[model samples]
Target chain A: MIVAANPIGQAITWINDPLNWTNPGGMLDRLGEHLTISALAVALGCLVAWPLGLWLGHLGRGGGLVVLISNATLAIPTLALLTILPVVFASGFGKTPVVVALAVFAVPPLLANAYTGVRQADPEARDAARGMGLSSAQLLRRVELPLAVPYLAAGFRTAAVQVIATAALASFVNGGGLGQIIRTGFGIGIAAGGGQIVAGGVLVAGLALLAEVVLGGVERLVTPKPLRRGRQRLGRPRAADATGSA
Target chain B: MSFRLSYLADPGNPWFSWQYVRDNSDTILAAVREHASLTGRAVVIAVLIALPLSVLAYWFRPLAGPILAVSGVVYTIPSLALFAFIAPYLGTGATTVLVGLVLYALLLIVRNVVAGLNQVPPEVREAAEGMGYGRWRRLFRIDLPLALPGIVTGVRLATVSTVALVTVGVLVGHGGLGQLIFAGFQNNLYKAEIMTAALLCVALAVVLDLLLILVARLVTPWSPRRAR
Candidate 1:
């Protein structure tokens, strides 16, 4: 009987409803809030994960340790991380605990991919750049970094998708996002709440897919010619990102 | 099973202490057990199916991209939504969670397995083939062992991520540590249960992942550590 309020149908209803288009609690506002949260958190995550991974990858030391560490990061539950962070750091950055939690969640894949991307760069090319009298910075910029661009973008793609999907959890902690609809809808009754939850799920999933498609496109644009034939190369960057669990 | 009278006597200490955890050992252990069984079963089942199919898929290069794309898209679905979507049909039980986990895992597991298979040194396969080793014999003796480190790496990633994802099952009442985390949050932020669950879940993930790595090392002694 309740299947009529099918998740897909419910999603369409929620999307079509004009009421949601208007106010503080409207779909647009929550979408904006969700995007802002994910954007800020991903930015913070890259700031930390990118430089550290870049340094580690460039030095060619601790490669095993870095991958091991990043791999292990996938094991800790994000919900647990989100909850534990607030209690552990009860003082600093009082207003945006969710951002901090999400940033932590977003770090592993970005770090893992950035390191692997740079570390995996063509060694011969790296040496050639060096032999040509390029400074350390120039070698990194002109050769290694460019080659690693696909991976860096891959990291961004994975991190962005994850942060956006997980950001829905913020509503549980009184933070703003589309999850608010799902949470409130559940309390109201299935026909309404259930439908809303379905719709909200669609929104989150849609956003994640959008991120994947967009980033995958960007990754393709930056990839060098020969590497394109080995589409399998895209697999490594993406594989680590998937290691970041729900 | 028993509460410490002295700890209870002090009403002023509002947060969780070691005593509180000691008192609730039975419930906590049960939840952990439930979580392990659900997640463990999903992984075991997935590897069994994925291993064979992926090996074939690797052999048949034409099918690789399409199959992987379908599975990858499945992974893109958010867990909660996937759970909800399936719940109505599956009737909201442990079975439903398994269905979701298995589907989510298929892509990650299958893709990694295929990737691992593909990475096996071509010469080793050629050598085995030249020896007139039967296909099955070659797969078991040469290709599999050589390809194992990669396969095991994929398994490690899949298992670890699966364990972490099991926590989301708290959305219903089935998730093991997830239930503790959810209950603690709902009950006025009972710090002890929340902290215990958090620490325990993390410990479980790290330990399981490390255990897999150690196993991988033991199995692939010939493979030197090289990653990019």
Candidate 2:
């Protein structure tokens, strides 16, 4: 059989080759690494960002500061952070720098969303809760948190997908991820590794898309049942909202 | 510890050194210029393409779903993957990077365009129609004016994100500040180079974002600052 000449065909061939998946540092290993790093970063981001955003949002005092901080962080280039953190912090190149950078990268959407979600909870419900003698904590837990679930979910999905995508940059710092495949392909020169590069791209893109779809479903599932029914009404504008920010 | 010239000249590995910045000012400036130009051009082209497409989507509701979906899918593609995918075909250069950045910018711009058009009050459009304004004229004169804030918001978002994403284009050899960052990393982890480039990239994003905000305010003098 003749080797396929075009990169696309070669990419297909590359994916078909079992050796590519099974070898050490191959697709499977890289895929695992990618998932692990992304998960870790997102988890870290959520842990730090969500509570701060939620508490501040609930108080309604620090929205300005929160937005300001998040926006400022957003401007810092991910690649720059990824490269510089390891050296400046003396952390050495690897997953540490990658995860820290990605976690920082993930924070803006999560924090902003969590804050917005809780802040936008129904005013009537909050008043009723307050009148009913429910404490602020109780109100947050029973009323606002539930109301904020959708926004929180949206933010989570955004952060997760973004972390997964940016995690590929880890390859630049000798960190593990599926980006290794693409980097390796480039290292081999386009003639020979063109297929490899394309395959790597397809894999990363596929993974990100898969995450998006899965998270989208999770978003729908986690939404309150009532909101689910009214979602058609609420969902349309929110779709535009999500797209604009995320 | 006494501050010493030796530390600046330290061959070991200094986190930052003004001397490096001074020596590489030309290279740094070039990277900054390239970064700014690539981001600016990509966003401009994206706005150009997204404007017409968004109008079609807004005009025909059915098109909005598919348009947003396609652009959403494109947006979801990781920058590295997108660039790598294009590089094989575009052969790794500014064009490939530009195409990828433009595609990334498309969804943000398109969504905002649709959202902006959505913001055009039905009554206003009707009033214009009642005044015998043609559909095109009403759209341009009435709907678009109302939509300006939203459209500008999208453009602002796209520009800032593009500034950051353009650094990823270094994979294809076109990342403006990204080259310096990558070079710093690859060249024995030169902190000054990486820091300088990174800080400059951030500054560019902030400057451009402010410029857009100023433009938005100038265009929509009627509306106070709308939180993006």
Candidate 3:
């Protein structure tokens, strides 16, 4: 029921306030907290997804299966999960529950990418590795791992962006983040010009875009040099296809 | 040490009692109906808008990059952030979440549809042209059928994800099962409310996904295997 009539103006005031910028729960702290949660979540996601993805990819047996299952998980609503999890973890309250949900959220992309990255490696090269007498472990570590870097990077970045966006829900669970401001501001209604909610929403959206741009840059850098050059030579159509879907 | 399984079977709990269902049937039915409408309307609207856009994207080679980039960016924005951002303009209630869900549905549907159309074999198009089929006729009769797998996949993905997202609508006061979930949270882990809410959400997702797959199969009888 609470919303400012002059929402945009309120946002400007909330975002610009020297006091709002300075306190423990200020914009800076919330942003930092959000980034921390995202980083930890993505890291944890990689831990859950990487090994199985890599194994299946190397074997060339179940990469698609793993990817399919993981992608299904990606469709699970984070807000729903965030609320549902706390009940399961009755003793758990805030960050831990948030982190667990987010970590699970991040897994699908990483799993999919890790699988495709390894499985899509040039078959001739893989055959050569086998012909050269590489053990399974050697084939995975020395051959497949390096080639999968780009896929790993893509997965990591995608999952990171997803986590960063979804992490805003953490505040609903009392987990400290930018969501608190929006929740409280909205709860209080049109008073204070509805600026706090507007400001919080802006900050979260801005953070999500920032993560995408930064990760996109990192993805470019991690891609194999030859493929990177090849991609540019092939130009925009090829590039668009690569990012056409998540 | 506390026993976890007992929580579900607690005799006093509404979750374990049919009486609770009878008592709350109207409220439960409304919430379920609300969630379904939110997801269904959003998906249908998204498909109508996105399907045309997808055809255009594939037709205009130059537009592909911009279209995909825009959708990808939109996809990353948190649903709540977008919901909150537009809430003031949309002015609360079901419309707010509907618009938000519609926006979220566009990227996936558009991408998959276009991808499906693009993957139609060149040889098939050549054959269609060789047979003197008109461009528009060939597209509808041939190309569209070939692309059915991917298009159906897009629909399936969007349907399931939208079902999951419907619960988040409660944050804006429009969610189906989410009302119960939020109540459970607010009521300090009311076991009956939280468990039932969670179970319903999970059930909705599974049921919707299976239903979509069945529909997809009936539509694309030729594509025996699942479209990857």
Candidate 3 CAPRI level: acceptable
Pairs with steric clashes in candidate 3: A2-A189, A3-A189, A3-A190, A10-A195
lDDT of 3 by residue, B87-113 (tens): 766565788888888887888788889
Cα TM-score per model:
0.84, 0.91, 0.88
For model 3, what TM-score does chain A reach? 0.88
What lDDT is reached at residue A60 by model 3? 82
Q: Output the chain A TM-score of model 1.
A: 0.88
For candidate 1, what is the DockQ-based docking class?
acceptable
Looking at chain B only, the TM-scores across the models are 0.88, 0.92, 0.89
Instruction: Provide per-model DockQ scores.
Output: 0.33, 0.47, 0.36
TM-score, cand. 3 vs. native? 0.88
lDDT per residue as tens, model 2, A1-246: 112249998999999999999999999999999999999999999999999989988998787876676667667777887887776555566577788888987887888888888988989999999999999999988999988989889889888888888888889888889988999988887778889999999998899899889998998898877777644323222222222222
True contacts kept of each: 0.41, 0.60, 0.36
Question: What does candidate 2's lDDT look like per residue over B1-228, in tens digits?
Answer: 645333334566666789999999999999999999999999999999999999999899999999999998988888889877888877877998899889988888898889999988888888999999997998899988898988998898888888988888888788999999999888877778888888888899889988998888888889866576
lDDT of 1: 0.75
Candidate ordering by TM-score (highest first)? 2, 3, 1
lDDT of candidates 1 onward, in order: 0.75, 0.83, 0.76
Better of 1 and 2 by DockQ: 2
Docking class of 2: acceptable
